[model samples]
Target chain A: MPYPKVDVDEWRLSVKGCVEEPLHLTYNDLLRLPQITQSVTLECAGNKRALRDPKTRGEQFLLGAISNAVWTGVPLQTILYLAGIRPEAQEIVFQGMDVGFRTDIPDLLSYSRSLPVTKAIHPDTLLALFMNYEPLPAKHGFPVRLVVPGWYAMGSVKWLRRILVIEHPFDGPYQSRDYVLYTRPDDYAHGVPITEIQVNSSIAYPTDQQTVRRGNQYVYGIAWSGSNNVTEIDISTDGGHIWQPADWIDSEQRYTWRRWSFHWKADLPGEYMIMSRASDESGAVQRQQALWNVKGYVNNSIHQVKVYVE
Target chain B: MPYPKVDVDEWRLSVKGCVEEPLHLTYNDLLRLPQITQSVTLECAGNKRALRDPKTRGEQFLLGAISNAVWTGVPLQTILYLAGIRPEAQEIVFQGMDVGFRTDIPDLLSYSRSLPVTKAIHPDTLLALFMNYEPLPAKHGFPVRLVVPGWYAMGSVKWLRRILVIEHPFDGPYQSRDYVLYTRPDDYAHGVPITEIQVNSSIAYPTDQQTVRRGNQYVYGIAWSGSNNVTEIDISTDGGHIWQPADWIDSEQRYTWRRWSFHWKADLPGEYMIMSRASDESGAVQRQQALWNVKGYVNNSIHQVKVYVE
Candidate 1:
């Protein structure tokens, strides 16, 4: 089901959690705060799962989220600060206008979640008023949405309307219910909580992706992760066993993808199996085989591409 | 030196790779092909290169490329089939009219790339004539471009005007001189090759990311990869040490993002780090840190998001 839609004027996010005085801000009201500028990434936690082939297939890269935009808004903590936190206030609840459809086990779903207070006051946390140098898109979240940087997209509440302080986690279908994980292979039981996106890579050229070889050429693509930042990415002209590292350009932001290039002489014509792999500081990297789960979560399989190198 | 802003009548891409006769396709002629439709992703080879922070304290998750659009145009191979291929034809090359600016290099950066004939003929690759149900935007390739599925945006040369075929890889600056991995920290002597983007994930919510308090709320985002299709994405309310899974809703296209949900109770309130990791059937998973290299290429590092548990 789609999130609840509202007229621009009817939209307002209420701040009642752990505060001295409750605060309510309308779409226009959010514009009044001392605007702060921040560049943040909001991503869909679930990425690549099924669909695979060294050649002739859909995109091998993960999906959803991973968008970066400039945000302008007021500090979330400032609002929380004004709403004097009660000593017992342990968490701040966030709710969105999106109401989900009815499910088999539950009556319906309303999108909402919560976080601890300390983070609410972080200097970077803001109620975003702008995106990509423009007002937010309705599809993205118009009016106001909670901005939580350096965190997964989940922290950002869209079509935001209500906020409250509570002593414990809110047991909603989405929170206490969804976003859990089953640790074991056969463990269909969802127990883990949902949050971070993992590091991985894909093959974009001579990509088993299967493209027409019209002439001599070049190839290009992107890579990224959340932990220590991208340090190295390599491509293999002769498949996974042998590989060569690629070049990178330095940048101011570390949460961005590092581009790479591989030279395919393509002089001696033959069928080639191209592949690429990425690794991070945590010593974690892509593998040849994929892990299995009932829901198919965290599929970080290596990428293999094929091309007729003329 | 942009591709000398050619008039639409003058803009055309020549199809010459391994074909019996070289076929030149004008803007109008290219648009005349059976208007095929497919949702494709255009990922900049170097998008989000600035941000990939897990250990460092910089904003990560800048989105570049990896864009989805419903494309319309002639299938690349359709034109190739008309031209007829030479059995010895080893590769297909694509040349573009877009030379937006001059790099430190001498020649204008007229985009160029190639695909083997087999992959180029795949049903999905299109000599794109339209985008998002509309004509091409000037900022984008106005006249025409190649739509190579499951590949980086670079290979889908924009403002395309030429298709060459050579026994060797297209030896243009972009072919090997450019877009190739030229350096690495540990192995400065040798560089990696460019091939594909690794399986990766990014934060799409909390777009203007910052810290947030934990409580009853819903966290949602997207994920994908170029190698394996996203199977499942895991979320971490804490930093990446532990992870939980989320739910995904099917959207229209394959390369497009599928909405996923994660509900957080936020019982623990403190400085909470939120992140997500994705995995694909090929076994490529996300990690907190990415491989460190000289010119960071394909930085598929784990996504780190900082939030506070109240």
Candidate 2:
């Protein structure tokens, strides 16, 4: 069904869910409301898992979907409060505009995600309407969207249309279909619904297979853990035998990656190696090998690369 | 002084801090060592800060030095084995090839930073010598750098030269001079050293004051916080009275901005206002009022823009 021919200036965002008075937000209504801003590290729910094979190619990025951008919108809870929600509303749902292959289901469907009413009403959550001070692009969801910070990108639905307050989880692929993790075969694939992403690190510079000489080389890279920023990063040149530590650039919070570097000299010429590891606020460290899944969602395996030393 | 030009293929990182053995590494040797890749978020020590007023454009962004990149290097500990230093080497000092800065300071001074010896052996650290699957760019410090996961950007020194295991912090401008807060006076009279960034956000698209049309306008922007990953964003249409949440795009780390949108309707004809705010992983959010400081390192104020309603 055709949504409407309304202009964005007079657009009204209807807020209906576990609230008090289903509220309708106008363009001015949104702009006039108090504003909020924060620095967040966003990673695609399916970021960087394709580089495992030698044939992988693109921007040379490891299946990248992680990027940082500023977002503006309204507090979802503020609208929920105005909307007058019923006590039975235990969940909050968001729907987006993109339609892609999402499992055995043939026809494409809009992206959608739902969270417990508790997580939904948190002040940190927003009903996103603007990106980088501009209107949304067609490819990036033009009309409306939901901003759930610290959660997987899946939950922040784009091209959002309606929000429903329910008691159980939604029947969309986001909840029951794709994001679930089953530890054991019979252990029930139903794992903790993906909400906040795990703390992770990456070697941004000096990717695998780089060539180097026997001289001076400074090592550098980034590290971050979704809800919990990076607290530490370690480097190993002799295959983990000896270690060195660089410096931390920021000390605000441990949820973001802090830049670090180490300067070293190579006396003899031969095949050399390089490696870096990181840990987050919760003390979760990057493991040597990440648990493999059919669809590589959280491939937090120890990332290793080879460089030719002549 | 010009440092040695090492061949990328024959380089090996040597870590010789307080470790048991001063290990030696080769380029390939570093790769062969236990390697890990993580999608961590990175935020510049000084990101998002503006001096109010139309003529108040000191610098549009204090948000440089912040970026999320994958790092591949040797664990710092393994390299320390090559030196077999005395246990008293409590400070891990790192120097980089990015020796000279555009500053008025005379002569070339390689950048440097240092950390506690304990952190040097931490497993998540790295002595990175390459960037983005390639050798470090000259602009980004060619030889090597340090990865300190969750600290400030200052710690990641570039164009490495030396690693001194000292008993005290290195006293240098590059290490303690640039990138600091401006508490000396309201206008950076005697700026202090900056250890971290503050909450910050921005509108990447339409930009400030850009006239937008009526119809389904996609509002867009980017947001970020210091070491915390942005977890929430809100938009205001009625000048802060009422607000609506937007759809927040997922990214690789907290340092990057989030792409978000909202569909505004311009059914009626008149002037309109727009604003945005961000919240981080630590639950710290941006306020509407901006603060004044010396260097304007961390300025996270509400971003405002205007549009017309049809």
Candidate 3:
């Protein structure tokens, strides 16, 4: 579905439910507040779907969908504080302006998700109004959007409309079911909510299966971790037989990926499986085998590419 | 030398000599005139200099010096028409605001170049004031710059201050001495001014000498011709013995390079030499051996990369 054609003058963001004093604000009201700008990278949860299986169930997006932009907005915590959250509030539900009927659910519903009150009031969580120093484009959420730093892009709800403070945990379909990771391949009996990003890396150059001449060559890619800074990236040329560290191209930035490069001298010819794995400061390393789920959520498995040396 | 910081308010571009009336225009005056915009690639004359022999004279620039941007300004033809060129005019000389002493000439000279009157009034030639939709950055020629599309960056002089019409051909050191191509390796006696770009292609991915794993791979790069649209890009994976056509990624854009990609299946693990050559619609093909020049101005020889698959 396309983004809702919202009338900025008529759009009123309501902060009700468990709030001590309910409040509704126009688009201009949000801009009047002190705004801070930050550069952040938002990666879709299923960014490497095509690599997992040639016929994945979801859109087979490559790494290009990810982008870093300067976002300017007011911190969600600032507004929550002004609304005077009730002591009983346990979660905050953010509803997007976009609405449609789900095949699985009979009733028409607006796309929404709920976050624990603690996560909602985090300083990094923002109600973003600008992107790349300009008013956000409609495709990227025009009037306002929610930005959850260090988390999967789904957490940063777009076309944000309502923020409801709930006294108990809110179990919306998107929050409790859709974005869940099924650790076992076959069954969906046990699952966990997908939150922070897994340690991940992808080769940006010498695109997948690139043919190269035999010689000393450089391999480079970008790596990132959701909740923690990427500590190191390792490249494997002999199907994990030997590993070497790739040099970091830039200093690590919080909530942003870092570029790395590795030099490899190919003395022999033939086919080689080149793979890159990333580890975060939190001791989280990309897994060789991703935990399969029907929805293909956080599949941060090691990224591999094949190349021919002629 | 750093960019000469010229006050925009004090700067006035003068069009004089061999004209019915001399014209003096401020920055605002240029913007007020009918404007045209185009996206053109500006490549330095010495781009890819490091690829040449180390003994080659002139600054060795790598690949980063080339950039493409949307330039908005009045066409040089429009301004020249307004000044009313005389039939006696043979050349149009452009002088930059920067002043420096040339050790060879032993005189303070504002860097300048002259184009034949016929070339000066070409519709694509622009007196650009804006780059990428924003006012040109100071380092990129702040108030105004001359943009000669499809020519080497030196032809697009920056920090432009004056345009002089001449009845005789220009013989400036830069035009006749520096940016000349020496056909013979050992002698500079037979030289010609470097004009339009040579048919060229460069590997943007799997950079120089990168190693990859054994498997299917895609080789892609950008190709462009100086005076005509790129027609075909051929890839040689077997040391230039076997050549294959790469698929064009997008429709051709005038004055812009086209991206092309090829699929290669790496079945053996070994070393290989990969090379790409471009051909233009004008029947100009990239040469296997570049013309040996003292300045290394147009080194559009076939680009080769050595990679090891293991």
Using DockQ, give the best candidate's number. 1
lDDT of each: 0.65, 0.62, 0.83
Encode model 2's per-residue lDDT on B46-140: one tens digit a residue: 45543343212123343244576777677777666556667667688886655554233546766677877776776666777566677666666
**Chain B TM-score against the true chain B, each candidate:** 0.86, 0.77, 0.95
Please give the range of 10 consecutive residues that has the lowest summed lDDT in model 3 chain B. Answer: B53-62
lDDT tens digits, residue span B202-254, model 1: 76654322334445756666677663476778888777677898777654345
Total colliding residue pairs, candidate 3: 26
**What ordering of candidates by DockQ runs from best to worst?**
1, 3, 2
lDDT, model 3, position A25: 89
Give the range of the ten consecutive residues with the poorest summed lDDT in model 2 chain A.
A52-61
Please, what's the RMSD in Å of model 2? 24.8
* Best prediction by lDDT: 3
Cα error of candidate 1 at position B17, Å: 25
Worst 10 residues of 1 chain A by lDDT: A51-60
Top TM-score hit = 3
Compute fnat per model.
0.00, 0.00, 0.00
Model 2, span A1-310: residue lDDT tens: 3332346665566666556666666766767776565555567655655543321111222535675556777788777776777888878777554556532455767677888888888887876667777765554555566777787677777666667776666778668756765544435445655667766656654555444555676666666677776777777766656756645655645233456766756555554456667777678988766665434566565555444443
Error of 2 at A45 (Å): 2.5
Q: How close is candidate 3 at the interface, in terms of C-alpha RMSD after superposing the true interface residues?
A: 19.7
Better of 2 and 3 by lDDT: 3
Which candidate would rank higher by DockQ, 2 or 3?
Answer: 3
DockQ of each: 0.03, 0.01, 0.02
